[model samples]
Each structure stands twice: as structure tokens, then as C-alpha cells.
Target chain A: MSFKDILNSGKFVVTAEVGPPKGTDIKEMIHHIELLKGKVDALNVTDNQSAVMRICSMAVCRICLDHGVEPILQMTCRDRNRIGLQSDLLGASVLNIKNVLCMTGDHVLAGDHKQAKPVYDLESVQLLGVVNSLNNGKDMSGNDLRGATDFFQGAVVTPEANPLEPQLIKFEKKVKAGAKFFQSQAIYDINRFKEFMKYARRFPVKMLAGIVVLKSAGMANFINNNVPGIRVPQELIDELKAAGKEKALDTGLNIAARHIKQLKDENICDGVHIMAIGMEDKVPIIMERAGLL
Target chain B: MIITKKRELQELMENLKNYKSFFLIGCSECASLCGTGNQEAIDSLTESLKAEGKEVTGGFVPKTGCQVLGTKVELKPFKEALDKSDCILVMSCGAGTQAAVEIFEDKPVYPTNDSLFLGNMTRFQMFDERCSLCGKCILDKTGGICPVTACPKGILNGPCGGCKDGKCEVSPDIKCAWVRIYERMKRLDKLQELCDTVLEAKDWSQNIKPRTLATRPEKKEEKKK
Candidate 1:
């Protein structure tokens, strides 16, 4: 079924992320897609995540289509301006790719290309407006299009970010800008997520709780210190630290499964978006551990 | 006010090597704080030129170099020195340099400093950019902190996912501007305003080049018509 159907189906949906290879060789990337063919509802293909140059997300999404897996084309404003973004949106529409996630990507300095120029001509809210405009048979400038798209677009939010007021303000703007669904940043604190959901429940759109698997105590600490909009609790970090290096991976899987199970059991959100980073193969195991399989 | 920084002394001298004499113009405004244009800057340039066997026609620090009419009124007494100079070396910002260009139509005007941006004097000799002059102001929405100047990516909504430890992902030295705004709003006990509002995408077209504003009142003759 299409991603939209799954969203409206009133079922606990599951989605996973897929990062394209840095080079032209997509053999390994495609294998991950095949492994997740029927395990997850849709795969979000990242666009040069962290500003590191990689294979195009559009190509990987197209490959997913050919391999019988649904793809959500993750679009960021870091590399492309308004014109390039509109062209790519049309391109995605013509390819029959139904899902697109709008975001203001990471800064270029955060990636390998520190010297690269960043193009933030349109941030997440503006990108959502463009999607809504395109769906209305017009472009951002009100130019008519010969063929328009019926894209099931989504946006991202950060619930556990420090000084959460701005994120809350932007979240309301995203909904008004035509965001049909939302996928949040990595969240480890269930109470915080539930508090955020108390506000989110007022919106009509579906929200998927973001889950970044912590492979070790060091990994949890790294995200807490290095990654923004994410708060890995002290208890979780200590739990992983207690598990020695050899069993840390297993412990992480158990932790992610537990979070997923809670998010589903308590109906804190509509679905869960699992980002294993390089461990796409372990997603099915997490689902199985959470009893979703 | 506009902040400016001086170009290297070597580059300035090379451009004016052909001219034997120069009249210096300085501003008492922001250029003075930056140490680019002031009594000290003029005296140093005068000494450096004399050391290189160049003649100093004369120099003065005007109260406001960018005010064209006011500067014109101040230059009345220096016509003799201005006429003797082969070139005008302005130690103020580009706006001040252009004012010289208008006053001395026949002489070549060179700027010793580059105009940076509208900034705040955070401390002595330390300046911080606070506005982008986007032709519109949204300081009310952000509690007076500017996202355009603070964010490396200039994302209008909020902090990007790259922020870590309340610092910008681009550089740890750069504190996340949005995070600062959030804190300030919370301290003021108006956090609900931040939660309920959403800043729109910046209208870049408003910042189009060569922006002009007419803030003066119209003539009474025009008003009567």
C-alpha cells in the first residue's frame, strides 16, 4: 500500500531510513532495500545527510520503486535553491514517488565539504508551502504547471531540543504550511515525548516518533554532546555503559525495541521512524523484538 | 551603525603611489571605534606617507562622514587643502568614501576601510553583527535576537538538527542563536508567545540591491497639491 494509505489506515505504521552510498556503486545500498522490502512501510532516502556528498536520494528512491519498496524522498534546502527544489519536486512527482519529507538540512560546514556554500533559500516551512502550492496545480510564484503532483509530504520536528519554545513555534508553522505528517528527531525521554504529544494531538496530521539506536554508552554520550535536538537520558547511557563492549550492540537493540514498544503500546504517536544509520539490516530484528513482526 | 575594518596599509599605498599628495577624511562615528578612521588613524597614515616621501595636504575627522550635507558644510574651510590634494583617501566606510566622491567630483577617492555590517558594540573594540537590513524587521517575533545574522545557514524557522550542546554545528565557538532567543523568551515569562507563533520565510526580494528610503517629510508645496 502507499504511504498515505498506511497513515490513514489507523494501524501502527513503521518506517526506516536509507542513506545512499558516497560513490556510484549502489550494490550494498540496494541490498539493504531488498532486506527491508516487506519489513517496513516506507524507506526515507536521505539527501547528502550531514552535508557529505553522496549518491542522489532521487536515484536511490527510484531504485526502491524498481525493487518493489515504497520510498520517501527526503528533500533538504542546504544544496538546492528555490528553482532547483521546484524542478526536483516535479521530477519526483513524474517518477510516481509519492512521499517527500521537507527539511532545512545541516550546514555545509558540518560535513566533509567545509568550504562548500550553503543555499538556504527556502527552509522547512517554505518548502512545505511549495509542496502545498504544487498540489494546488501551481508553483511557488503562482505559475501554472502542465502536470501537478499529489505528493504525500511530511516534515520533521525536534521535541527534546533545549529551549523547546522555538521548535514548538516552528512546528505549528509546518502544519499550516501543508505538512501532512511529521517525523521527529531522535527522542529517548518518553515523558518529554508524551508531553510534546499532548500538544501534537491537537493537530490532524500523523506524527512518527524518531528513534536513533544507541549502540553503546559512548554512542549515547556522543549524540547527547554532538547531536542537537536529541536528549539521551543519563539512565539510558548508564544502562549501555553497564553492558560491556561485546554486548553493547544487543543492549542497544533491546533499548530501541523497548522505546518502540512503549510508543506503540501507549499510543504516544501514530508510528515510529527507526534510524539505525549504517545498521539498516538490524531494523527487522528491532521490529521482531518489539513484537511488531 | 555601520562597522568597518581597514585594508592593509601596503595595499592602500600601492594604489596611491602615482599620486604624491592626499587629503585624509575620517569619521567620528563607528569608524572611530573600529580604529579605522579617527585622529589616530589620520596621524598614522600621515606619518607613514611622509616616511615614504609623500606630501600630506591635510586631514580632519568629521562628526558624521556619511551625512553628505553635513560633511559638505564642514569641508567649506578646507577648500585650499582639498584643492592641493591629488587624491582623497577616506578612512571611513564605503558610505563615507562615496560622500567624498560626491564632494570631490574631479579627484579619485579611495577607501582605506571596508564597510562590514550594521552591528552592536558588545564591548570595547568588540563588535557583533545584529541586523541584516532585510528592509523588514521581525525582532518582535524573535525577542530582539536576529536569526539572519546568527544562523550560519540562515534558517528562519529554528535551530537546524545540527545544533549540539546549545552551540551551532558549524562551529562550537558559535552559540546557536535560536537557543539564545528561546532562553530570553523563557526568562521574560512569555514562552507561550514563542510556542504559538511561527516566523515566515524571509522575503529576500526586500533586500534587493541599492535599497532607497525616503524618510523625510514632503515639501509643503507638494503636500498642498
Candidate 2:
């Protein structure tokens, strides 16, 4: 399905992630693509998540498109300058990668290498502005492009942050900057997410509340304490902890399913992003449990 | 040209309890180079701050942060924003951060990143710190490739035995500096010099570390006076 159709369908849309392989081997990628095709509305290909070197996200998206999966190509402003970013957007248009998620990306220091430099020519919001400018047939410097692009531009939002005001304000700015849709950082607390949805509903943009699968209680707590802007509530943590070692994966799936069910039941968001991290295989099962299948 | 990630705007908002109105400044030059304070980052910061319940009185002013020319133009448009602000959160390198401090002397100026050094972006979102500016350059001997700058270990005389099949031991994909020097010399047909000259160990003191270059000609003139 086209991303626009999925957005307008008014159904609880489901999207999954497909991280490009680190090397030239596309076998794992192909498997995940096949697994997610027809099962989810769209797939998001991460561009070097955590700054570790990987096969380009564009190439992986192309593979998914060939296999009949609509791909949301996640493009980051971390590595490329404005010129390169503009060129890549044009290239994505040619390749027919319909959706683009612009991000500022993790710092080079966050990756394995300690001494790497960064090229922050454009952050995510300006990139959205630049994309909007490109759509109007002008580059960021006001120079005209050979042809204009019509991309379903999207940006990220973190709803579970302690100070929820920034996410809402950025959400509004992103909408102003020409962002049509938003995929939030993982949502673990239903009440907090509902509060975020209350503020988010005022904006015109579509929101796909993120659902990250917790491998264990420890993992969820780590993301809550260590990862800024992500706060998993104590109840969810206790639920995962009670599941024990053998049933951890089952507990994670159940938690994800419950979150999706609540979001769909409450009409909290336009869509949902199921991020299983390395557990891509379990996503289909979670979707089935959520009755999204 | 140190590269850094600002604590996410949401996190920055929580930390900023006292500040009400603030100036959100970004660099148009080197901070852009290091991938920190550019227009894109500034916009994100602006959106993020506005969402956090603080009034963002300032907008983005892309400046060189190093030279006065860009700073001068930026100061005019940003003056009102600066005056309205309780603090200035600079999204630039140390030079740009200090420039903001000097320009807005009375206002509180905060650095978004710990300014590291001039570096080049490498493959896979990685940034390699290549340039050290050791005061003296010896590109003449190495066929335009400096072993000291390029090599991870900083070995000057020859390739260490750790080099395996032309790749540095430190990073497999990264080429050995000596291998690159050899190829460059070979391309220039200076390969025969490898046998004739036994180069001495580099004098450690000659390349004495912390080197600074003054770009402000007026400052140099004042020093001369």
C-alpha cells in the first residue's frame, strides 16, 4: 500500500523496521523483508543506527521495493552535508522510495570509533525545511533544482520524556516545517502516551506511536534510565521482571501486543511503529496477537 | 572543530529550570563542519525549546564563529533576540562558543558541545581526527601524505610490522599510512629513494604539540606594538 493510503485508511496502521546488514550480505535483510511484506503497511530501513558502518539504507529500501514492500527510508543529517543530503533525496525520488524520515542521528562518539568527526551541515528540522524547499523546486541556498520532489516527509518525536512540552512544540514546528507524519521514540507507558496524544492531536500531522519490544525487564529499565527521553513505567518493568528468563521474549511480545491494542482501542495515534530491535521475526506474531493481521 | 551531540532538546529543557528566554545560536562554518551547530540543529533546538514551555525569544543566526565578518552580520539580526534572552545556548565549537561569549559579554553563554578538534568525516558516520597542526609540516618527504597525521599510531620512520596486507592493524578497512606513502611515492616514480636514504628518527621537540595560529591580524599588530 502507498504510505498516503495507509495514513488515510483510518485503520490502525502497522509499520516495522528492517536494519540494513553490516556487510554486503543481503540474506538476513532479504529474510526480514520477506517476513514483513504484506504483513505490515510499510517498512522503515534505518541508516547506520548508532553510527556503526552498515550497508546504505537506500540500497536496502530498493531491495524491499523490488520485493513489493513500501519502504520508509530513514535519512540522517549526521554523515552527509546539505549538498549530499539534497542529492540523496533526489536519488530516493528516482528509486521510488516514497517515505523519508529525517533525523539528526546519533553522534560519531556514540558509535564504536572514539575519534570520529561529524558533519552537521543540516539537522533534522532544517532538513525538513530543505526538503520542503526542494519540493518547491529550490535548494536550501534558494537555487533551483532540475526537477521537484514530492516526498511524504516524516520526522521523529519522543513522547515519554519527563518534560513533554518540547516534544509537543517540536511536533508543531515539524508540522510547520512540512512534516506530514511523526514516528515517536518507543512508548512504554500507556498513560503517558495518552497524555502525549492529547497534545499531539491538536497538530495536523499523523503520529505512529512507537512500540519497542522489551527483551527483558533489565533492557526496559536500561532504556528508561540510560536512553534520554524514554521512560518505561514501573508497572511494565515489574510485569517483564515477573516473566523470568525463559518467558522474557513471551512477556515482551505480550507487552507490545497490549500497547498496540490500547493505542488502537483508544484511537491514540494514526499508526504504530513496531520496533523489535534484533527480534524482527517476532513482529509478525505480535501483530497477529494485536489482531492487526 | 570538535563534534558533539547536544543533550536532546527535551533533556536540555529539564536541565534549564531557571532560564526563561534564551538565544539559540548556530555556526555557519566549522560547527557545521563538525556536524553540531548549523541551521538544522538550531531549528531542532528552537522547536524543542518552544515545546518545553520556555519562550524562545531568539531565532537562528548562522555565523562563521571564527571571523568577525559573519559574527558582525549575525549580531545585528540576533541583537534583539540576545537582549530578550536570559542565556545563550551556543551550538558551535569552542571558538564559536567563545565568540558568542565575547559578543554577549553580560549574557550567560553555554556550550552545547565539548569542542574537540579539527577532524574529517570518515566512512560509516565515523569522524577521524586527522589534523593535529604540530606547527611544522613534512608533506614534502612523504609525497603529499603525512604519516604523522594519517597513521593511527603516529609512527614516522617506517611502517610497523603490525601492518597486515597494506591495512592498519588498528582498523582493517583503513589503509596503512606507510602503504599509502609507498603508493604515492611509487606513482611519482620516487620509489628508488626507499633504498638510498636511511631517514633518522623524527625529533620529538621540533613537532612540539600545542600550536596556535592567530587569524586576527589586528591582535598580531597590537602584539607587535
Candidate 3:
């Protein structure tokens, strides 16, 4: 089904993120894509997420499409300029990959290779502008193109950030720049998300609050301290800590299920983007526990 | 114009360090265009020297080394190497060599290679300087062929007056620029103008003198203020 139809259906549309492998071994990625194929509305293929280089997002998306799974091609403005971006977009359109998620990626310094050069000719906002421009059959330089693209453009948002006004402002800007949907950063607090949704309802774009599967208390604490705009409250951290060593994965999945159930029950968001990181296998279990399967 | 391999750069670094206090100079113009001695190249060279147990002090400066502007600037930041070493391993074209010689006056300046003619950038890994920057630009009149630049003999009058089945006297692959120009002009229906003007000898002074550097005072003030 088309991404637009899935969103407009008004059901609790389930989505997930599947990171491609570091090398060309597509076994793990393919397994996850197939596992989540008909179970989720769409799957997002991250583009060098967290500043770590991996297999090309487009290649993974192509594999997902071949496997009968809908793919959301995540693109970051960190590594390519507008020219390369437009070229990749045109290539995606030709390849029949429809969904896209635009992001201002993590800084190069945060990656394994610190010396890599950053090509930020167009930030996320400007990238959205370029995508809109290409839809009108024109490139960033005002050069006319042979044909146009009709992509289901998506953008990212962080609702749990302190002083969430900036995110809200950027959300409005992204919607104005032709972002049809948004998938937020990991959400640990449902009330905070509800507040975000109150502001979000004024706009027309659909949103899917992020639900990252916490592997352990340590993992939750690491994200809380290291990852900006994502805060796992002390109560959840303590609960994960109390789960003991052997049941860490179970506790993590339970927390994820709880988050999803709260989001669905409260009607906080239109969908949930389950980011299990390396634990893609447990996504189905989390969905099942949340009564989404 | 001149291309230096990574191994050649390592060898040059060794030689520069062995001699006198050395300043590994880079060019921003031709070197950048050639993609051999830009900032990225300099950084790689610096890392190579560090790996080889040498404490060479050097930094990169943008602009053609042969230009007076890049030379007059303070290279003293690399003074530790310059004061202790005897030579400068300049990664620039021949123009860079002249500029380094003019700046260091007494210091020995060695060239990596002879600077060649101007060429179009084919790819990231290759560059071919095909143009000689002849005074006249007859691209519009001759469908983008400079007979003076491409022809080895700088023949502007005719195809060497010895047409051996439309091939040049220099080489078979090297199609005579005039022949190509004439054919292109004929295709474009502008062949009549090709016979109208008799070209004269080029004035060497157009490129013979040293280039002067000029900066707008307002731009400098705006940057400073």
C-alpha cells in the first residue's frame, strides 16, 4: 500500500527502523526487513546514522522493496551536497522507492573517522526545499529537469528535548517545507509527548513517536547521558536496573511495549517507529506484547 | 600541470628533512587544480612524516607558490624546520618554483617536475592540460578550438600548408586544430569568417611579466572591522 494510504487509514500504523550492516553482508538486514515486512506499515533504512558508515541506504531499501516490504529511505545532509542529493532522489524515484526521511545528520567529529569532510551544502530545511523544488521539475540551481519526483517526504523531530519550543518551531518549518510526516526521537515520557502532540495537531503532518528498544539499564543510562534530546526518566532506568542481569532483554522489550501501549491508548501519535538498533529480532515480540501484532 | 604520486611525496619529504630546515610548501591554484598539493595532500604528507620518526615542522599555505603574494606572507610558522633545514620542497608548478626562489632568495628551491601546459580536469584521478593560453580566443569563431593553443607549432594561418589527408605534421592522433576548426565552422555555416582575418604574431608581453597582486582596501577593512 502507498505510504499516504497507510497514514490516512487512521489506524495505529506500526513502523520500524532497520540499520544496514557495516559490510556487504545483507543477511541480518534482510532477516529484519522480512520479519517486519507485513507486520509494520513501513521500515526506515538509516543513512549512516549516529555518524557511523554502513551499507548504502538505497541498496538496503531496494532489498526491502524486493522482499515485498515498504521502505522509508532515510537521507542525511551530512555527506552529500544538493547536487548529489538531487541525483540520489531522482535515482530513488526511478527505482520506485517512495518514502524518504530527511535529517541534518550527526557531526562528522562524532563518527569513527573524525577526519572525514562534511558536505553540508544544504541543511535539513534546505534539503526539504530542494526536494520540493525537484517535485516542481527544477534542481537547486534553477536548472530544469527532464521529469519530476513524487516522494512521500518525511522529517525527524525530538519531542523529549528540554525547552521543546525549538523543536516545535522546526516542526512547523518542516511542514511548511513539504514534510508530509515526522518520526520523533525515542520517547520515554508519554505526557511530554502528549504536550508535543497538542502543538503538533495544529499542523497537518502525521507523526510517529520513536520507541527505541532499550537493551539494558546501562543502555538506557548511556542514551540518557550521551544522546541529546532523548531522556529516559529515572523511574524507567530503575525498573530496568531492578530487572536483574538475565532478564535485561525482556525488561527492555517490556518497556518498549509499555511505551507503545501508552502512545496507542492515549492517541498521542499516529504511529510508532520501533528502533531496536542491533536487536531487530525482538521488535515483533515488543509489538505482540503491545497488542499491535 | 605537474602530478606527484603519494610515494614521490614521501621521498620529497625525506629529502627536504635530510637537507636544511625544510618548509613543505603547497600551492592553492595549480596544485589544487591538479589535486596533488592541496590541504588534503599536505595533511597526508604530515602524517607520513610523523609515522617515519621525524619531527618536521611545516604548514600549508594557499595560492600558487610561484606567485609573489604567497611568497611575501610569513612562512615563519614553519620556522623550526626552515631555520634548521636547508631547502624547501615546494609542491607547485614551475611558477611556484620562481615564487619560492624569489621569497627565500638564498635558500635552495627544488622543483618536483617541469610545469606543463593548461589542461582540462578529466576526473578526480586524472588531469590533461591541452591548452597553451594563446592570446586569442577563437572558440566562438571556430567552434571552441584554439588553433594557436592546441597546434604544437602554434599554426594560425593554415594546416601547416602541408595537408597529408587532414592529419597534422606533429602526430596522427593530434588532429590539426585548424582542420577541426574549419570543419566545425563549415558545419555551423560560419566558414566564411575563418578566411576573412589574417592573424598577426602574438605579443609575448601579455604573459611574460610577473603577475601583480591587488586587494581592495574596503574588502580588507570590512574583514578586519
Candidate 4:
């Protein structure tokens, strides 16, 4: 089923993300896509995720389509100017990729390409507006389009972002800029996510609580230290450490399943976006354990 | 107002190789505060040129390097020295450097300092950029912090997911500007005010090229009368 239909069905929808390979060899990436085809409502193809050079998400979206899986094209403002970005959006539409996750991607310095010029011609908030304009049969510059797009555009929110006020402000702007749905940053604290939901509930857009699988204490600590807008609760870290190296992956899966169960049973938000990172094969098992399968 | 840092002495020396004699101009405003156009800076350059066996026709600091009329009047007494000089080297921001260009249309002009940004003097000899001059001001919505200047990515609504430990992804030393704005907004109790309001796409037309503002155009008409 399409992501839009799943959202409108009033049922808890499940989605997963897959990163494109850095090199042209997509053997492993295709394997992951096939594994997730029947399980997820949609799969987000990350575009140069974390600013690291990878195969563009558009190509991977087409690959997903070929595999009979709905793909959400993740677009970032790091590599493309407004003209370039608009042109690519049109291309994605023509290719029949409907869902887009608009974002102001991570800075170039955070990725491998420190020397690459960052072309954030339009920030995420502004990119959403550009999508709105495209849907209305106009380009960002108000030029007439030969064939405009109808994209189910989405954006991300960082509820755990420090001094949450600015993030909250940007969240509302995304809604106004025509974001139909949201997928939050990796959330570990259920209580904190609930607090964030209190504010999110007032908005008209649907929200997908983001659950990042934590494989080990070191991974949790690494994400906490390096990734912004993500905080792994101390207790979860201790629990992962307690699981030891051999059982860490299984422990992390249980943690992810537990959160999905709570998020689904409690009806905290519309759905959940499971980010298993390299463990795409484990997503279906997590779904099964959470009784979603 | 604007910050400037001196170009390397090696670059300055290379530019002076063609000119046998030079005239130096400095600004007493921002340049002085930035240690670029102060009296000592001019004296140091004057001595260095003299040591290089080049004629230092004259060097004087101006009250305001950008005030063309005022600088023109201030430079009248140095006409003989300027007449002897092959080039005018301005020890101030680009605006000040261009001011000399305008006055000495006949003489070649070069800048001794690189013009930086519109900023505030954070401490002695330390300046921090505060405004990006994006033409549109959103400080009222951003709790008085200019995201256009402060954020490395210049994101309107930010502290992107890359920000770590309340610092920018570019550097550990650079505190994320959005974090500062959030704290400031929280302290001011205006955090709730932005829940519904969205800072829309900036009207970039406000920052169109060659921005001009005539503060007192009526006074010019009155003076003409």
C-alpha cells in the first residue's frame, strides 16, 4: 500500500529507512530492499546520508519501485542549489516517486567531504514551501511548469534537541510550509517523546515516532556524543552494557520492539519510523515481536 | 560596524614593489578598534616602507574613512605628498578602501586589510559577527539573535540534527547559534509565542545588490535650496 493511503487509513503505519551504498555496487542494498519489501509500508532511501557521498536516493527509489516497494525519496539541501533541487524534485515526480522527506542535511564538515561546498540555497523549512509551490503548479521562482508535481512531502523534527524552543518553532513552520507528516530524530526517552507529543498533538500533521535501534552501550554513547537532537537515556545504555558484547544486538532489538509496542498500544502518535541502520533484515522480526506483523 | 584584518605583510610588500612612493590612509572608527587602522599600525607600515627604501610621502588616520566629503577635506593639507605618491594604500575595510578609490580616481588604490563582517566588539581586539545584513531582519522572531550570521549553515529555523554537545558540527568551539537563541527565548518567556508563528522564507529582495539607504534625503534637498 502507498504511504499516503496507510496514513489515511487510521491504522498504525510502519516505515523503515535504507541508505544507498557509497559505491555503484548495490548487491547488499538490493538484498535489504527485498527483505523489507513486504514488511514496511514504505522505505526511505537516504540521500548522501550524514553528508557522506553515496548513490543518490532517487536512483535507489527507482530500484525500490522495481522491487514493488514504495520508496520515500529523502532530499537534502547540502549538495544542490534551489535550481538544482527543483529540477531533481521534478525528476523524482516524473519517475513516479511520490513521497519526499525534505531536510536541511548535516553540514559537510560532519561527513567525509569536508572540502565540498555546501549549497544550502533553501533550508528545510524553505524546501517545504518549495514543495508546496510545486504542487500548486509553480516553481519556487513562480515560473510556470510544463508538468508540476504532486508530492506527499514530509519533514523531520528533533524533539530532543537542546533548548527545544527553536526546534518547536521550526516544527510549526514545517506544517505551515506544507509538510503532511513528520519523522522525528532518534528518540530513546519515552517520557521525553511523550512530552514532545503534547505539543505535536496540536498540529494537523501526522507524526511518526522515530526509534533508532541501539546495538550496544558503545553505540548508544557514540550516538549521544556525536549525533545532535538524539539522546539515549542512561538506563538504556546501562541495559545494553549489561547485555554484554555477544547478546548486545539481540538486546537492542528487544529495546526497539518494546518502544514500538508502547508507541502502538498507547496511541501516542500516528505511527513509527524504525531506523535499523545496517540491520534492515531485523526490522521484520522487531515488527513480529511488537505484534505488528 | 564593520571588521577588518590586515593582509599579510608579505602580500603588502609585494604590492608595493612597483610603487616607488606611497600615501597611506587609515580610519579612526572600526579599523582602529580592530587594530588595523590605528596610529601604531600606520606608523609601523610607514617605518616598514621606509626600511624597504620606498618613499613614504605621508600617512594619516582619518576620522571616518567612508565619509568621502569629510575625508576629502581632511586630505587637502596632504596634497603635495599625495601628488608625489604613486599609489594610495588604505588600511581599513573595503568601504574605506573604496573611499580612497573614489577620491583619487587618477591614482591606483589598494587595500591593506581584508574587509570582514558587520559585528560587535566582544572584547579587547576581539569581534564577533552579529548581523548578516540579509536585508530582512528577523531578530524580533528569533529572540534577537541573527541566525543569518550566527548559524554556520545560516539556517532560518535550525540547530540541525548535526549539532552535538550544543556546538556546531563545523567546530567544537563554535557553539550552535540556534541553541543560544532557544535559551534566550526561553529566558525571555517568548518561547510559547513561537508555537504557532513560523518565520517564513526571508524576502531575499531586501538583500539585493548595491543596497543603498539615504538616511536624510530631505536634508540634501534642503541643502540644495
Q: Please, what is the TM-score per model?
A: 0.87, 0.59, 0.62, 0.88
- What are the per-residue Cα lDDT tens digits for candidate 1 across B63-101? 999999999899889999999999999999999999999
Write the residue-wise lDDT of candidate 4 on A45-80 in tens digits: 998988899999999999999999999999998899
On TM-score, the leading prediction is 4
Worst 10 residues of 1 chain B by lDDT: B194-203
- Name the better of 1 and 3 by TM-score: 1
**lDDT digits (tens) for residues A233-291 of candidate 3:** 88988898899989887998998898899889988889999888888888899999999
Clashing pairs in 1: none
Evaluated with DockQ, which candidate comes out highest? 1
Better of 2 and 4 by DockQ: 4
Q: Which of 3 and 4 is ahead in TM-score? A: 4
Question: Where does the lowest 10-residue lDDT sum fall in candidate 4 chain B?
Answer: B193-202
Candidate 4 regions with alpha-carbon error over 4 angstroms: A115-117, A141-148, A281-285, A288-293, B17-20, B50-55, B157-159, B162-167, B171-192, B213-225
Task: Give the Cα error of residue B59 in candidate 2, in Å.
Answer: 49
Candidate closer to the true structure by TM-score (higher is better), 1 or 2? 1
Docking class of 3: incorrect
Model 4, B143-206: lDDT tens digits are 8988778887888775676666678878888888888887887798877765555566667778
Total colliding residue pairs, candidate 2: 7
Q: Rank the candidates by TM-score, best first.
A: 4, 1, 3, 2
lDDT of each: 0.89, 0.76, 0.74, 0.89
How does residue B208 of candidate 1 score in lDDT? 91
- Candidate achieving higher lDDT, 2 or 4: 4
